[model samples]
Target: MSDLPPLDPPEGDGPDEAPDMAAAELALGLLDGDERAVAIRRVLAEPGFARSVDRWRTHLAQLFDLWPAVEAPDLFARIERSLDRPVEAPVATLALAPPTKSRLWPALAGLSSIAAAGLLVVLVARPVPVPPAPSARPTAPVVATRAPTLVAAIDPETAGVATVTAVYDAQAGAIRLTEAKLVGDDHSAELWVIPADGTPHSLGLLRARGGTALTLSRDNRARIAAGAVLAVTVEPIKGSPTGLPTGPVVAKGTLSPV
Candidate 1:
């Protein structure tokens, strides 16, 4: 925490009190660069600040959702108007004359209406993407994070010479399956998710060799809460026909907290 960048100074007159205006400005994209970075940090770290930001976002979204659709002014026409201004031209050459002014962006400053038009287009049905959301950022590899995850070992001795491993990613709601010992191609390795109630649920099948990722449904994810068991069984191609296990359990282990 000490190594992280210092947060931007709060905007209120008092040191402890930050005005809701700060959150509104952040949500409205009034802050740029380091100020925006500080706001993003607050959104993730402080629940109160996050709620303020969400409230401002919802308020603004509702206000604009009912706003009348406005057509965009012709951009090319505005550019033409900007170019139509009288200016001295080089008469020495028969070739095309170069532009007299260097500040073209400043000249087209009137295009704010065009920006509003783009907003209208987005408001019709689609959304204009907002940045700095959690999903908008690149994810760090699971191995690189400091947070503990869950890993369970599949039954190693029963199936083959190779050992099998299962690592669960709670954020992604998926389990990664790694097989060090390859099973024969003729059979299938089906994964069973054993809940605390001693009931077994099928999580799907695994590959005969290498690694595979198995995703769990919302209800199934609840069953995987700590103290659950994960195991692999040798079954017929595709998986078990009956809901219950038909083949012998090859590998089984209780889920462990990292």
Candidate 2:
């Protein structure tokens, strides 16, 4: 009978051993944390290590493909009977066999590859209890529900003024404004939200386009609630010189939850 190659490197081997062993360990998911990170960096940076990892992965996949299929005819019945049995802690033992072969030098390289692949599969498939790393934290699932949105249609009170439609996203704290016509270049369109307190807080200046999105400050977002009024006014080139509106209110409408 032919001597089989060892699944792992010889016990005395250390970091000074060949890089092929490290690459194999990485491909088999044996390394963890900083060691695994360093291995991954090598795989990316070193062409030789990358090729080794690819070879190991391909060999392992081929080993899995070559594995014989077993039929568990009484598996369900066995599981049912085991349910009635009292649970006990699992027991395991480790045993090492003294080297019987002076050298496992197979005549063919294919024979060595097959032996190495089979041993790697066994090592990787063995069930081992692993405790979570200290730094690993369980994350709570984020449940996303639709955020409340409010829409307002600001109609022109007088002729020659553009009509505006406003959509407010409460979650994003931003308001999207759609206008029928662009505001004149000489005059700037200023947006304001008037809450129940009747205080108008300036949102920002609207651009001379079909629509624009304005992100609100925390204070301004709070003022944008149901029944609140959204008003657009013609101001100076930049905006209202003073905080308050200094020009005529072209269009205004009340916001309601959509």
Candidate 3:
């Protein structure tokens, strides 16, 4: 058997056709943290993926068995009986095996032109478990920033748009929404926060069209952080009926250092 799999796949084994790359990575212990976490969840939740992981493990074991056996080096001191001369001794020195070309990298490289294609391929191959179905309730988007303060741009006017901005004082637990375009007589602009976990939390309705300030609950305030997604949705005069967004996400932005 070959010591390693082919660096390139045969025709038809393109990205669209390959689903075992992730399984190979997982079995090789290449994935880390959330990436690994997601893969593990899929391994348990997806029977097909689990089977792929098993197959990769078997193949890896075969590869190891094919590796050329290396003998350990040793050193010793010896004396000649006639001259009583000390001879060079064989000393065993610890050594590490040279890094071999990984099959994962070749597979990922052949599949994608992207730099760091392994990570991109893993991500592009499968979604990170957000964007639930329409029938399901939406959760907050992942909060990726650690900024003490955050600001966002909100412009949802389809006819005549105006500059709108929002600032969240995470420490003070206060959020201020300033709009150049006021909500119409019956329409209200609702505020929503999408957390790192990718769940949506409605902050509340914007009471003033020009500007409004409100404090978030203890639980909701904790969701304010860098890389968090802030969104504004236009709901009825009273806001969304289902608590989840019922209207389009007209405006959105990421959290940044204040």
Candidate 4:
């Protein structure tokens, strides 16, 4: 809204004057000072004037909604520079010299002769490349190796419930989690890895909606391998009350190298 002066009202709300014009002014925030105060009193006192103000406000709001917001460029520095110094006209200009005839052809001919003599000497002195012996053996091809990545498609305990896809990168020591469905707003989902020892170790809390990445500790990273069990359970918002999972396990699956 602009900080503008209030619009002057009509002398009277008579049959000849349009009182609705004043209502429009008030709705547009063009009414301030005593005029704004009086318009506010009329809005409270008269139901007809109140309705007029409401209609104008709604119409103006719809006009604003029709256009998308635009970001203004930052010109503060340029404005400050202009204020600090007045612009001045350039004092001098550079000009190119006119071309004239010269003995360039003779000079170019002499340079070409020198270059030809140097090329002849180099060609006479350079050694010739030789062919390899036919008995030489061929080199072996190189092979590349990549670190193993573990994947788990965690299935829901009950049919039609939330599911999770866990991918563990051994080299990065991080696990990427992709959740299928949302959990209860009051509760949070947690991830756990159960190794061959049968003890479940807490990985971290899972995000309710989208995919997330969790970096594991040195000990936790060592436990992640093929055949390890990956599970998700519903727990408190922060995490499980106990270090172990207290809530029911929602999804579980065995990890396999991918």
Candidate 5:
């Protein structure tokens, strides 16, 4: 057997076919048991056969586990059949052994090219989303309009003080007091709006100087239109004892439409 010719694979096989022949030889070597470990390792290094390498490893591991109990007939028959088949050559076959030092750079460059192409594909396919503008939505203005009736000032007096000037704008339905002054020390001032005919409604406390203005509610519009009396009293800080004026009259005004 040693002197016999190296088994020449069937006709049409040439040195160009050496790689496929080598792979088959490696596969058969895996079943032989002696060099099976080395051959299996070599098959794992071939990219084209890498997936099969895992299957081969699992099969071999099972064979090793059953080695003592029974022979792996199925595994041996499969390898034999595979070796008998004509080698359909791989378009590119990697060396089963490690590459020469000189080829390392070329292999690295090829892998980098593949990675760069993958990154470029990802960047081109995915786009970043832009946020919408805030001002695109509408917003209302603050301080919508002037209060219909604004009381501008108040006057305080000890007794029998009169004259509260009402600045009325008929179209806007508003009235404002332009002047209110306290005449004496004994009396406190209060503000009221008299409608066209109804009783005086208390707006709020009145200050002697730099007096404040008060806005009336919408419900008072009709009564104000009917001529309700706007009057002021020199009420105690707790307010007029009787719901009506107990203190001296201080100032009075009416709301005109605006």
Candidate 6:
């Protein structure tokens, strides 16, 4: 609900400055609340921020499991109060002498040597484990691979009617549907996956011409696997019959697992 603009580079800033700005924005998003914090963590995990992103990761991880139980408004007020408190300044120390031009080469050489030593230490401390070749690994048994089932479908016209199509993707454990057209100017369409043998289950309503992809519950997946007759019926803007399909059938299809 917060009207935060999408993160983008500010015009005219130097290349190096952009990354720092982005990091600061990410930190601000984390302070927004739980949802924004989770989003920040996900975005920071991408390839661009992989190396130096650990600081924010560690900071956010500390609060990962603490957000949900606390009420947001109260927590926000507490954080705001904490930020308003003053902090004591640390005493300054004498500045170190700047390195001379003649010392630059030696400094660079020393840094290279340290880097090489660090790499060697890492290699010696933890050698990479070799994975077995694909041929060397044992193969598992094959379960029956069924093709995706067409659970429902809709066509624009049939006796002045519209059609709806629904399919079951066993692997994804979801029900997908495609709507062809609108049947009635006022009535919306609702899709139902009726088990051939048992009770009918509502797969939720569909927009007259809008298609949707939805996941089914474990129990519904099992029912669909057992062979369900997918059906579509006309309904009010809200939905269909309180407990049954009271409207005329728009389209219906029998599903067979492939």
Q: Write the per-residue lDDT of candidate 4 for residues 1-258, one digit (tens) a residue.
A: 789887776678565765447789999999789989999999999999999999999889978646754554555545444433423212111212222212222122222212222233223323332211233354333222256777776777776453455778787899886544535889988889999999999999887766678999999999998889988888899888898998888878778774
The TM-scores of all predictions, comma-separated, are 0.42, 0.43, 0.40, 0.43, 0.31, 0.38
Q: What is the lDDT of residue 253 in candidate 5?
A: 38
Clashes of each: 3, 0, 22, 0, 24, 13
lDDT per residue, candidate 2, 126-226, as tens digits? 34422113333444434343578777766666654444567787888998765334357888989888899998889998878656889999989889988
**lDDT digits (tens) for residues 1-258 of candidate 5:** 279877968986776755543344554453556556556666677676655555555665655645444332335435444534445224113314333322332232222212222223223323321211233443333332334433212222333332344443333554444335643444566666665455666655556654344555565444454234567777876467666666666554333322
Model 3 C-alpha lDDT versus the unseen true structure = 0.63
Report the lDDT tens digits of candidate 1 across residue range 46-110: 99999999999998886775666555444654444443443412322333333322232223222
Give the whole-model CA lDDT for all candidates, comma-separated: 0.63, 0.68, 0.63, 0.68, 0.46, 0.53
RMSD of each: 21.9, 26.1, 23.9, 31.6, 40.3, 27.4
1-258: candidate 6 lDDT, tens digit per residue: 589987785786766554444443465454467745654676667655543355665776778556554322335434434433433112111323333422332232222212232223223323222211224343443343445544333333354433334556688788665433545668766767777575677777776555577787777777775346766777786677586777877666656532
Model 5 lowest lDDT segment of ten: 109-118
What does the lDDT come to for candidate 6?
0.53
**Candidate 3 global TM-score:** 0.40
Q: Which 10-residue span in candidate 2 carries the lowest summed lDDT?
A: 100-109
Candidate with more favorable, higher TM-score: 1 or 4: 4
Cα displacement (angstroms), candidate 6, residue 206, comes to: 1.1
Candidate 4 collision pairs: none
Error of 1 at 85 (Å): 53
